[model samples]
Target: MSTTEIKRIKSKVKTNSKYVSLITWIVMIYFVFSVVMLIRAAFLPEEAFTATPGLIFWQITIPINAGFSFNINIPMEVLPNYEPERFQAKAAFITYHSIYLLTYTSVLLYGIRQLTYILWSITDGHTPFTINNSVRLRNIAFAAIGNALLAGHIATICISIFVTQIFSMNILNISFSGLIIGSLLLVISQIFRYGAYLQEQYDTTL
Candidate 1:
């Protein structure tokens, strides 16, 4: 090919890559907006947690269990039906909310890391799933592990709440169960870290 032809080919490749990157950025922005809306709509309102059975699940349950009160904790002035057990339930609610807060932090961290990977991949003009572009994929996998750990936290909280509130399980048993789950999560996360390191080495060699 002539010199001019070669230059035009390279220019086209760069242009296409930039276009793809722009689309990626737009999609990521939409994703972030959706996530924020979901959290607000599903969990933040008063009616969500105190619904029919008074049991909110998943991400919504996290804040409820964690005890972040954005006007949701206001007590009814008139106790419609006074019961000692009802007061105990309210105390339990507070404890659950506190636990949820800790777990929610993990989720938010993982989510931010995931978005970082997406942005980096787009800006670098790197394909997310190619051997020649393995570094970006490795970053994505690390983010996945973060997400997995956060998911595990949610699961442990849910199981504990179910055992304690629904089935009246013992506290010691619940604590032990959570410990085991957390340990497994650490092990899984380490494995992902190792894989990411290996991919980084491979990329450097290339």
Candidate 2:
């Protein structure tokens, strides 16, 4: 290769290394934030945060992008003042919550596995690697799928929580909290993905 080409390659490698380092740092920060939130939840009373089991699940698995705004307009009469109707509604809520939780747990586990694979591929250095290029692509695909799953799950959970809040006539501050958290999660996810892309580009040039 020409001297100019060699310099360009070196520059790309340097850029990629920087990106990887930045992304790794961001992930560690996010994990620390999660730990802090978990600790707060453990210490605080139920009234402090008011995140239901499903909401907790959503918070735990930000990879799925599972937080979304939802409209909840329920008429008073339709809810039925009768005890039996209320009981039925409660039962339905329980069932829905159970199914979503189970699905999310499975998706979360898979997502973690995918993340590990991606991290492994990125960290693998100049050694004679046995794994083909397809492995990296496969890991990215798996991570994307996991993100999709989490998005759906988070949306469902957010909608449910919104509805419950409205039904209870609670304050509106929780929506803002969700919005802030969701935005942060999205940025972090993008950063990690972009870092990976830069790493791949740098590797290809080498």
Candidate 3:
């Protein structure tokens, strides 16, 4: 790549990468806050928990603004029946949510981190066609696929246990976007790998 092109790529990515980094930080902070709150909420007084008529879950809400609010739900606990066993179920349900939060956040941060690195690589005196970039893209693609496959299975299993033992229902969920995008990215990663190989040949010829 030419000096001017490299400079341009660096300039563009510097701004975008900074924004992505900011978002990552925000997500981290939110996750920590959520974990602490989820734990505390689990053991809250009965008054803190509410169940609407005909609703299948209990919820607690904390006001953020006049119109904004933070809400947490306890699953598998039907309305008007605050059985003691529901407390244990609440703890288990909270664990599933915590796992979901951590998993989602980890995938999000890692994928964007790799993307940021890929963007800035050109700035560091390296061409866009590099094996490192292909590997990073591949990592992101696999992460996406794994996340898609694992998507609702965790929560479904968690909730399904209660549903089967207590209630009766069917559950099914899938992340089509993740599957499609991940598959496309896998192809793109291979293309990038081939491009890097060709770039190596060109450099060697020079």
Kindly provide the TM-score of model 1 when superposed on the true structure, using C-alpha atoms.
Answer: 0.31
When 1 and 2 are scored with TM-score, the better candidate is 2
Better of 2 and 3 by TM-score: 3
Q: Backbone clash tally for model 2?
A: 5
The parts of candidate 1 lying over 4 Å away from their true place are 1-90, 126-206
* Ten residues in sequence with the least summed lDDT for candidate 1: 71-80
Candidate 1: clashing residue pairs, number: 6
Cα RMSD for candidate 2?
A: 12.9
lDDT of every model, 2 decimals: 0.42, 0.41, 0.68
| TM-score list, all predictions | 0.31, 0.39, 0.75
lDDT of 2: 0.41
**Model 3 ranges off by over 4 Å:** 51-69, 72-89, 162-172
Candidate 3 residue lDDT tens string, 92-132 = 43555676676677888789889878867765667778999
Best prediction by lDDT: 3
